[model samples]
Target: MVQPVSTLNHPTLLESPQEWDLSTLYQGFDDPQLTGDLEQLQQTAIQFRDTFRDNIKDLTAEQIADCLKQLEAIAQQSGILYAFPALIFSADTRNTEAKQMQDKVLEALTSIENQLLFFDLELKNLDDARYAELEQSAVLQSYRHYFYNLSKFRPYKLSEAVEQTRNQDSLTGRQAFINLRSVHLGEQEYEPVSTPDGKSCSTEAELGALLFHPNAEVRYNAYGSVRSVMQQHNSLYGYILNSVAQDHKLENQMRGYDSTLHKQLLADEVSEPVFRAIMSGTRDRFDLWQRYYTLKGQALGQTIRTCDVYAPWDSQPVEPLPYKAGVETLLAAIADFDVNYARRAEEFFLKNWVDAKVRPGKRGGAFCWYIHGKHSCLLLSYTEDYNSLFTLAHEMGHGLHFAWISDRQSYFNSNPPMILAEIASTFNELLLLDYLLKQAGDNPALKKTLITRQLEDQLNLLFRQSTISRLELAMHDRATQGTFDHTFVNDQWMSLYHELCGDAVEVLPDHQYDWARIGHIYFKPYYCYQYTASNIVSLACYQKYLQVGKDFIPGYLELLSAGGSMDQVTALKQYVDVDLEDPATISAALKYVEGLLDQLQATL
Candidate 1:
């Protein structure tokens, strides 16, 4: 059974690498050279603000470019300082010192932000002819991508006074309420759930474990415990939802965003039609998922409920895999896609790029962070399960992608949008699945089960997340219209969820409150659709690579390295020719899933 979230800090947690060998960034955060560089940048920022904030219009293109370069350097240093321990804290929320370090760096960053608030404002003021000339200027040419991004936001840019007002208000506005929600939501207590052996389990941990449990009762009881806790706190969650929705309403209207979906689409550099295509195509695949669940319920001899959705195909407990074998297996699987991808992942593992151990006060979940100009840091809880192996491969994919980009782009242009961020990781998962399936060769039952599980993975990443995105959009729209309250959110959530699960599994009444526990809803509204988008793209690309053999691997590498320097859709097209707006792409994925379900039924 999964342990309590708090147990992440147990003394038995893995020891993190002390150095993590980040010579690629700076020798150390406190190294004399880096310290000297940081101090110089800080002073330069001060000088630039003092010298040019009031008279930047008269500056030459060379002067503006030189100042921007200095600002980029300073921002890079701050990001490097923030990445390591921030990652450590994410791996274990209980780490007091790491948390403190994050706070200190955040405060320092705010100071730096205030110092350079005038840079963009002043740069935008240049006359059209001068701006065009600057675009071709030798110094400014290096920053073409950055300059283009700024130009895109020109229409959305407010007057300097109004911009400053919104910037300050941001701290106490919708963002603040979201942060406030995290504190209370993260600490909410669910009742202890009982494992198959009748041992008490942590609510958070139990839910995770139950999802993979072979025993139907275990999954049911665990889910019951989770729902009980959520229902108990329903009223409190309602108030937070109302407050945040009202805040979004006020701000979205003030900012002139056409609709709730428009904000996310704009941020993702895509359009509503693209997102709608994904959602609609995936939603239409619910019958395939339902058929699979029907077979699953029949195999288990139980009435399939929400909890039963995660029961393992085999009733036997999976033996724990050794760490080295797990790592080797994943690397080999990824190698099938591109040898260099596997090698890069191996380098990170060997170089202590991963913080895999669970520790006290460490946070739950997994992530990969590209620490400025230095190196990537990965944080995850490794239990040696198949799930953990997939997670390791996923995050390693993120690291390898970032490594490629860091080798290619300047600090200012290396960031990819969150919508496209999952593509690399999910791509790794598909490769791993291919590897595992190949090894399972003649073991029919095992092969079938593996395929079934992969189908479940697709369902969650695509179909289920689409449900979340729709719910988020509905909530945001209603809230913006000042019509959303607790009841409204609960009802909308249930309706959307039912559409995904179909008639095969029963969702308990209390399950409607499940949205309250989803932190992503609080962090980035309508962001969950990215999982669906990325999975569809990953599958489409993996299919092409498999078809074309080694020739396509080079193109795949180019896509990874291109990063944000190119538009996400363009990079995706460079590797795979599918258009996201074409419903056929997602329909192809669903058809594949339906074929798997048919195979399972035929075997039965």
Candidate 2:
């Protein structure tokens, strides 16, 4: 959930960089240069429309190259402009100035994007000879993927008049429904029940506190609060679901998508076989989690419930990790792989590159935003806990990944697809686990807990999230065929939960509306598959690093720096030689989970 725009009261996350510069985006949002860039981008988009909108169908080789280069430049600067304020606002959503800047830039950028929508349609309309001539050009040849990508959308293209209607509908059609739903859902208050300690909390705070609480009763209270609150507005949620699903149906029919998942998969540039492999392999390992809950239930001296699933196992007496120690620990872990990884991380830490403190009105979760080639900023609430340490390491991985890629590629080529975005960050967590395990040495209990945590990561990415993606596919498929109802969607969602959970533990009756709290469903449909896919790839690469020692660092570094210039599969193949289509990668991850189950059983 986003922090409200009225909550910010300080400058912890938005402070200026001490090492790298972000002035490339603008000296600040208030910078005159920022306004100049906006005006310039608008002018350039108009000039581009005037110069090539009609000429694309008859473009000579040189003219095609010029247009492509200009388009790339426009996109790169536009990204910087949006990136700066969006990142700033994400960290401190209460900053009205930042939010206003974000909205202003987004509105301006949307207009620019709309202006260029015709370029692709027009380019695809060219004769074979004209396209052939353009393709033969060196510049166009280099961007073959980009050109082919635009051509792939020719099937979805409507007539100019219909396209214009879609342009308007895109803002107010499904998107508007989604935005309206967001405003309603985010504002709906969930009451926090009285805890065993007799302390009161807000709904989200109680959930956060429950996950780490030593007492079982607190977890149950948190769960009850969640149910009670969600129940209050169940009908509103149902209405939102129906409206959004109908919106999607309207758009899908207009665009002529073969399947509901087809549009999302096409954008990802991956295949259904690969997605199914991850889902199936993860489902097969459901017993690993069943075993885990069995162990957890034994430790807790009772049956494990939905609320208990999140709390720490047996509440180990680990010390709180201070912010500096967390940063240093992460650096030491990265240092084991390569000096470059460690040095880059240290540079980020020493500079004002991270907003690590928690304050009122600040957003939750951690993210890394790359402002340009030279700089990035991390937003996180640095709680003094083991999980928070891992969070820091995870976001740092993203920051350094951005840096590595931006340095290696042209500005236009630096944006990786969302499917590959999780790789570098997950890789860091793998490295951190390796570092922690080695340090644990003969400490069986600590090692067991770490292994369990690792298995939990698998449970989340592969089993839980992958299952959610499948459910999303089903929901959207039904909606496309005119199936839009609250009860039907809720029933389907609950059925999916049963399949994924698979007797791991007894699911509470009230948990049927679990999908309601999952914001990703409303924002990015079928987006969870990437987490599962990346986990499969990360485990494979991490295992290789363990076996081959220093020999793997060069390949790993190359993978991080490869970025968006190449396809995700091609970039992954450079470091880890596994066919994503093959079931082997998923099987390997499941087998690793199976091994952990054995270790956990022995500890018990």
Candidate 3:
């Protein structure tokens, strides 16, 4: 039998670092090396522009490759320069020095980007004969995909002067508004939540964790307290959302894209049909989502509410999974999949590359930030429940993906597109789920909990993410026609929630303003759909692993290793023989969820 949560012992918990060691990036913001690197980056960027500008059309294939190599060096430097302060600022959003340094770095990088903007525009504007000649060059083979992806933007290419103006204007334009949303969220205080112990103050992260509180009233009130803050500042958030959306719409008009979604998918190298396939397939399976929630309510002996969506099935508070235990569990799962994969992941923990502390002013959600040639760092407020454990696994999956890319690819290909980005992370979660389920053995409660968690995770990734993407489509459409306020956004969100939930759960009043808290809508517009797309891909990949066993390892690693070096669809097909373009592929992913739902029902 699996050990009880309360009795599971991990001695290393005492020695594990709570805060990440930023020393890997720099000693601190005050480190002279940080300053010197910024200076060096500026000098290198200037030299690049002077040498490459107005000369791309005259360069040979070898010269073009040399230019790209220099550009990649500049990009690597800029990645480190930006990542250092950005990671620090994320760790402590209230840190004035870190925030200021981040702003300075962003401004400097934007200026550098403006100076180098002509190179890409010139390449995009190259005559068909010249572009085809370069495309066939053996010397340029390494960067073939890179330039092919760039050429997709030719229709959207503005003149150099116009593009430069837009690039510089963004500091005060859309970007300034995005930063405002971040800073505003980081500063706001949520009302204290009443737990069984007592009434306690909460940060956004703390308040979020309470949604899983074993007590129904606590979950409801915590949800209200979190949303009340958003409702209170709904006007300001509405303005920020509208401003960002308007900026996107204006740019779409200027760049000649049909819509914001079109522009985003182009960058992702994902075709429109595949996007529609996932969204449509997900919407068609709303019944499975509703069925899971109904089963959850039955198991918990209460009507489901939005707040109770994450509540534990048992009425007992779950014992915290200490950071050390979480890391060990995660590593063991990966190691089970392949020892070499586990070895790559061990570096993050050994090198102190993760910040897993819960603190005020830290960012609320989790993210893995990978510096091109250095390493990846993860930031998450670890609340130490099963959710946090899975989150740890998820982000480490991203860290490992970056590690593979860094090991095998050039700096130019290190960053995968957003569509391919979440595959490793979600795949890691599945591995953890499988490991936990196997460990559960004849332990019914443990098995139920693990199965429920997996089902809910799939629901969120496949259904809720697509709902958010649908909302983005609606909001952006409204922006194109005119402007939308919080009221319209709220109504649309509730409508979509009702459509998806289908009376399986109670959609409360406060749930209407939930859109305010979705940072991606304000920051990234149409980015949420990528999670849905990736979840589909990862589920399919996991199924292949099950069927083929260890034989799946090589191709899976190759997919991650390919990084952004190839288009995601091509990589998926060539590596794993998974055709994302097929509607059956998407249906198969939903069927996988249905199979999990069947298991959960059998346990119930």
lDDT of 3 by residue, 321-391 (tens): 76676777777788889887887777777777888888889987999999987899988888767888888
Q: Which has the greatest TM-score?
A: 3
> Per-residue CA lDDT of candidate 1, range 37-112, in tens?
5566567678868987877778888778778777778788778766755664565455566556555555555556
**TM-score, predicted candidate 3 vs. hidden true structure:** 0.97
Query: Can you tell me which runs of candidate 3 are displaced by over 4 Å?
Result: 1-17, 199-201
Candidates' TM-scores?
Answer: 0.88, 0.88, 0.97
What is the per-residue lDDT of model 2 for residues 150-248, given as tens digits with 9 covering 90 to 100? Answer: 666767877766776676675656666655554454344556656565867663533554555667777777777766656666666666766776766
Compared with the true structure, the alpha-carbon lDDT of candidate 1 equals 0.71
Number of the top-ranking candidate, with lDDT as the measure = 3
TM-score for candidate 1, residues paired by index: 0.88
- The clash count for each model shown is 12, 1, 0
What's the residue-level lDDT of 482 in candidate 3? 99
Deviation in Å, model 3, residue 95 alpha carbon:
0.6
What TM-score, to 2 decimals, does candidate 2 have?
0.88
lDDT of each: 0.71, 0.71, 0.86
